[model samples]
Target: MTMVNLSFVLFLLCGVLINVQIARSDECITGSIRKLYEELNCIPEHDETNGCITSYNCSFTNDQRADKCYYQGREFSDGDRLEHNDFRSKCIPTCSCLVRDGRAEFNCAHYDCAEFFQPPLKKNCMRTYSHDSCCAVGVYCKKENEEETAATCEYGGKVYTEGATFFPNEEPCKKCICKPGFSGSLESPWCEEVFCEIEIHHAESIRDNCAPVYFGDNSCCPINFHCAHASSDETQETEVESTTITQKANDNTPTCKFGNSTVEIGRKVRGPEECTECSCKVPPLIECVVNSECQEGKLKTAN
Candidate 1:
């Protein structure tokens, strides 16, 4: 080949090699940022913002002189206007990068080491109840950092983005059944609780008519009534007795049967037979009925 041709071919090869190297360098920087965040358990706080590093900011080796080595778009030029002139070299020693006097220092000793790290999503993996992954309400979610964090669940009526703080264990996961007179809506609806209990009130002679009012269990007491001394025949006994009423036309004595013996009710009869013969002994009556006619005067009392 001619010298000129050879030179042109070498130039083309050099261009291709430079492009590949740059690409590799960028990827390395990006990968390092990710690794550093992982080690520190750093989660991104914003949902829309991409991670701290991009391909343009990453590289295979920790170069102290590269402008945009740590963050995408943000570069540490040795002679940038104002501030620390040695911004690039300091970040080399540690992954912990510090900004001082307009200069950035990299220090990996401990960078956001307290954050909760989110595991990468697995291929075709389904999400299950993750009680351990939940955090408290009101968190600045990120992919890996706590303050700058993000989530991968649904919240605030919207689906959470990746790397957000997940409130898997929060009270919102399970809902409490609302008592009566309450309504549930879409944005904020009540959910059924694991176990719910209900209360009932009852008064003597008036059993509680308690039944399940809503999504809970109910109880009844003194609220219920046994058929008044229900007979083997399943009849409720009466509460009143027989009385004697003097008829305007005739003062004939009225009688009632009391335990196989006839006695006079209200007339104060001396003998059971006499009372029964006199039609004064009132018999036990069924409930909801007034047997005061057998008695002298009408006295009202409920069973």
Candidate 2:
């Protein structure tokens, strides 16, 4: 062969060998690291000739600088120990990471008596319902009840079990159905709350002042509102009785009179007195309805 041709052939052979080596090197990633990369969506650019990954392209952030894998700006790596920055309770402790069943796992230390009983420097110690020791700064302990007997009525700070029903107060709507327990304990006694139906004699006057008129049965009439006539009333030319009204609160927006307080749209007004809850809603039509805890098992209707 000629010298020029021989040189060209040798050069081609060297290039082919180099490409093969690159391809081999690119496939040399560790199995665990490959899986980690895949999970992070890190597609490494492979060098065909050396078979080595040139770039991981894993998302990195300040917090994950030491991690081999990163995703969504968070860094993670196997066999890492970390502590929760927010929670410092005895039940939760420092955690360690591990690879389990091809997925990342965190093993946290279990709660211990020493940690649970540790006293707070400036807080009182209280026993939890479970009898565990806890700081009492924000804890609400159950009130101690000396009289364990169940009773049908509670009057003058004394419990009585003589009747099947009792009136807790003079309010016509406030009463309790006596349901004596076998153990005769006052814990969660059964009581049926009644909400009386209220009617405003002069609803028009309330509408004139832009004030919501409340009705018993948890409904309220807003100012400047009108109710649609019934199908039967529509066909007749007789006078249509106004069934709806509209009123406004401070903002001139629609308001609902729930019990004694007036509630505006998107605002919460609680009462009749403390035990009741209510809110005013708009959209689909503006209306006020009773949303009280005493409303359970009762028909819910909007006024």
The RMSD of every model to the true structure, in order and in angstroms, is 40.1, 31.1
Q: Where is the poorest 10-residue window by lDDT in model 1?
A: 195-204
Candidate 1 residue runs with Cα over 4 Å from true position: 31-303
Off by over 4 Å in 2: 1-73, 86-91, 113-303
Position 284, candidate 1: lDDT: 17
Which digits, one per residue and each the tens of the lDDT, describe model 2 over residues 1-303? 999999999999999988877667544532112322333344565544456653344332222322232223344477666564422232345655555555444455754545357665333223222111122223322235544333334554655443334444333233344444513333334433332111112222221212221333322122122232223222111221232212233453434333233444354432233333233432111232343444543534332
In angstroms, the error of model 1 at 217 is 49
* Per-model CA lDDT versus the true structure: 0.27, 0.36
**Cα deviation in Å at residue 201, candidate 1?**
63
For candidate 2, the TM-score is 0.18
